[model samples]
Target: MKTVLFDYGNVVSLPQAPEDVARLASYVTGAEPGFEDRYWEVRLDFDRGSLDPAAYWSHVYGRPMDGAGLDEVVALDVASWSRPNEETVAIVDELAKVGVPMALLSNMPVCVAEGIDTLPFMRPIGPRFYSGRMGLVKPEAEIFHETVAWLGVAPGDLVFVDDRLENVAAAERAGLAAVHFRDAAALREDLKTLLG
Candidate 1:
């Protein structure tokens, strides 16, 4: 049986709200022009569990952070990415109703993963893999192999959906079928063709 593996950010959840991102930046004193750039610069390391919350925030802030400050920033950061994409979520629901095997793979930090796991939509997806917990991130073949192994399925039996083309390409290289997720509508059509 084929298992549909979905990417969490952008695919499952909507893009992080701009205002919420701004709130996270506010925690950085004298935030500069390239705050977003800085955030992404070390984000993979943060997502890969190489850097813990305090260290990650400190690097993004370009200075050391206090405990209270870190707490607020972490909460705000998690909240920023917490909004659900109702359309995609509906697709997940439909798949679940039919007993389609589904799983989630996300390059998310542990803190954010914890927050995301609490959402009602996430419950139907089993054996969710987070880069932070696995010490690996997507667009890397190893993570794909590891996930395939964990699922006890051949790589070709998994249909991986990701918004990022690079990750899609990597999944293809890893021998899993891949879909470049543009939106829920496109994804639904793709799944019909692939799953049929």
Candidate 2:
């Protein structure tokens, strides 16, 4: 394969600090007692560019955030997305050893996505496709095509790995080979078979 598109959250990284989801749920509860389930929908809206981030944030909180509160929210949620998986990094290194051009494709918020440049793996991971930056989200079809275009590879020459089945299905629909990511070991085995 000439290109391998990777998903970051769950597939590559996770909440680094801890209790992030629970904390977010608590924050949402302050606005609406039972709004936690709505949080994911809001996040998806933000990622897919269906709603402007500030507007979404305001809607979620039921009020506009002060600059400091906004900064805190971004820092607490987006910037705290997580640390990289060493095993996944090793797999990326293995893929690199064979000269496969890899790109990261993730539904990430702009604040966290921008901080990706700080990662060594991300630096060498070819062009990253952050939904916030691209104003597109996966399962959308365009992102898959766009990433392939960015990598200058045919969809058939690319493999996409993501934790979400819908996202993987979308990759398949877009004519790229797809892998459903479970964990480091499963991913290692799958990639070993794919790239070995």
Candidate 3:
């Protein structure tokens, strides 16, 4: 493989915790109960760029928020999704040291994408594609195809790593070799074998 494409959530960043989700639900449940369900119900639309940040938050809150309230909710929402998986990041650093070509592919909203861009770990990884920016999400053949085209590499020449089985399966269907990421140790082994 000439390049390695990585999924951000769970692969590089930590997965969302149940407690975190509950906390977010609590924040906006003033007018609406079941805020958690509402938050997730429209997440795909939010991540796919179909809903703006304000609209997405409004859906969660079940009411329109003023400028200050919107900014607060946006900041909290981004923080909830921004936790890093240190072990995975270390693996990425090792790959960088060895001169491996890598790029990021993440299902994220524009607000979260902007926040991730400012992260120290993400700064080194360029040409990252966010679903919100690409207007696509994972487990879809088109996102993989579009990423391959953007990287100027053939699908067969690229290996994708994602924590989700469905996303890994989709990458294989899209003609890219894929790794179902479980831990950094396994990822190290996979990369060694693939790059050998």
Candidate 4:
């Protein structure tokens, strides 16, 4: 069976708002200095599972977090990225109705992943592969290989959809067909062509 791999952040869920990040930065004790720059600086390691939540937050806040502080940061962090793109979600529903195998693969931290798990739209996912869980992130060849292996499908039998061109390119390099998702409308057309 052919399978479609979906990217979580921008493809299915709404992209994080800049204001949201700014709000979270305001709550961080030490984020006054280059808050946005700092967030992205350490984000890769955090998403790759090499840095645990506490360490990742500390790196962002410039101090160790107390239990309550940890909870707050984790909540805010997850909330910032949890908004759903209703249109793309509808597409997921359409695909599921027809039994098109679907799975999720995204670069995310454990806390965020756990929070998103409770969302209604996340229920149809199969064989989810998060960077936090897989220790692999998109645009990396290994992740594509691992995903294909886990799905028990050949690369040609899978289609990967992601918002980032680099990620789409990487999947292509790894031998999987990919769509650079610009919007839900484009995605619907792309999937039709691929699945047809």
Model 2, 48-141: lDDT tens digits are 6677656777777777865777667666666556677778887888778778888889987676676675766666586788888787888899
Candidate 2 residue pairs in clash (backbone atoms < 3 Å): none
lDDT of 1 by residue, 156-179 (tens): 889999999999999999999999
Per-residue CA lDDT of model 4 for 41-61, tens digit only, reads: 989899999999889888888
- What total of clashing residue pairs does each candidate reach? 0, 0, 0, 0
How well does candidate 3 score on lDDT at residue 61?
A: 83
Better of 2 and 3 by lDDT: 3
Question: What does each candidate score in C-alpha RMSD?
Answer: 1.0, 2.5, 1.7, 1.3
TM-score of 3: 0.92
Sum up the clashes in candidate 2: 0
Model 1 accuracy (lDDT, Cα): 0.91
Model 2 segments beyond 4 Å from truth?
15-18, 22-35
lDDT (Cα) of model 3 = 0.85
Give lDDT: candidate 2, residue 111: 67
Q: What does candidate 3's lDDT look like per residue over 62-161, in tens digits?
A: 7886698888778777777788889988988888888888998888899889988888887557689999999999878899999999899888888889
Deviation from native of the Cα of residue 130 in model 4, angstroms = 0.6
**Candidate 2 to truth, TM:** 0.86
Q: Compute the lDDT of residue 166 as modeled in candidate 2.
A: 99
Off by over 4 Å in 3: 29-33
Ranking by TM-score: 1, 4, 3, 2
